[model samples]
Target: MAGDSLFGIHGAALEVRAQRMGVLASNIANASTPGFKARDIDFKQALASLEGGQGGGIAAATKYRIPVQTSMDGNTVELSEEQTAFAENAIQYQSTLSFLNGRIGQITRALKGE
Candidate 1:
């Protein structure tokens, strides 16, 4: 209970989001690298599994992204798609952080009885 109370799903979410950002950033960085396959995290699936008591941490949620069009250089990372996913993940990360901060503030106020 102590562990859950201090962080809960938001903590896990932050970790996952950070990891996803890294994956997306790597894809963007290697967009021109031959045979580079894009990877992504299934956010909704990961959250659902965690919430349902299936504990695998963040690593279990990652998946390879399927490209709509394969390049002649054998690179699979789509720059535009990766950029979109990165931006979206960044927004979600910020939202989770804001939520965690609010939760912490609430707890602080409750402890002070004011």
Candidate 2:
């Protein structure tokens, strides 16, 4: 019962989101580095595969990001693109956390007969 209640799709989603945040943060950090290519995870595909009995923990397949405008230094890390992706991922992470919190609250209330 403990395991049943603690682990679910939302839990998996949170883990994936955290991983994505790390990748995006890395891209942002390497924005000015020469020849650094921006990389990102395929969130939807990874999550779907994970939920479809992939027989593994939450993980995403990292892929290089294509730049709209090529730089002379061969750096593909676009500051604006990285920033946007970071913001979107952060929002998703927070949303998943809030959902998990609400689920916990519901369970607690039920246990207390409230």
Candidate 3:
């Protein structure tokens, strides 16, 4: 159960990060759209909900995005902010992958008795 839970948690975090990246991309893509506001996911709350027996936290985030900036023309996306957030999210995602990979390597080594 613990291993299943860890895998589930890691998968959920990965999905959330991916979706957040998509949102960030959407914001960047619609930068010229007069009324777009940038949006983001609440990772902490999403993860909590998933871990609280909610059947994977990533599902909690796939549907919608919370606006970070509201525009006069009803647009919630801001180019500069979206770009910054995207960069940061990408960095975090890479770090998460690196850590997962390291863990995998350790597991492999232990299995091989190396």
> lDDT scores for all predictions?
0.86, 0.82, 0.70
User: What is the lDDT ranking, best to worst?
Assistant: 1, 2, 3
Task: Please identify model 1 stretches exceeding 4 Å from their true place.
Answer: 6-8, 53-55
Error of 3 at 72 (Å): 4.6
Candidate 2's displacement at residue 38, Å, is 0.6
TM-score of each: 0.85, 0.85, 0.74
Worst 10 residues of 1 by lDDT: 50-59
Find the number of clashing residue pairs for candidate 2: 0
| lDDT tens digits, residue span 1-114, model 3 | 255443556755665678788877887888778866556677777766655657645555544445665667877665676788899999988887777778779888989999
**In model 3, which residue pairs have backbone atoms overlapping below 3 Å?**
35-74, 35-75, 36-75, 36-76, 36-77, 37-75, 37-76, 37-77, 38-76, 38-77
How displaced is residue 64 in candidate 1, in Å? 1.0
Candidate 2, 78-113: lDDT as tens digits: 899899989999999999999889989988999999
Model 3 regions lying over 4 Å from their true place: 1-9, 55-72
- Judged by TM-score relative to the true structure, which candidate is superior, 2 or 3? 2
Superposed on all Cα atoms, model 1 deviates from the true structure by an RMSD in Å of 2.1
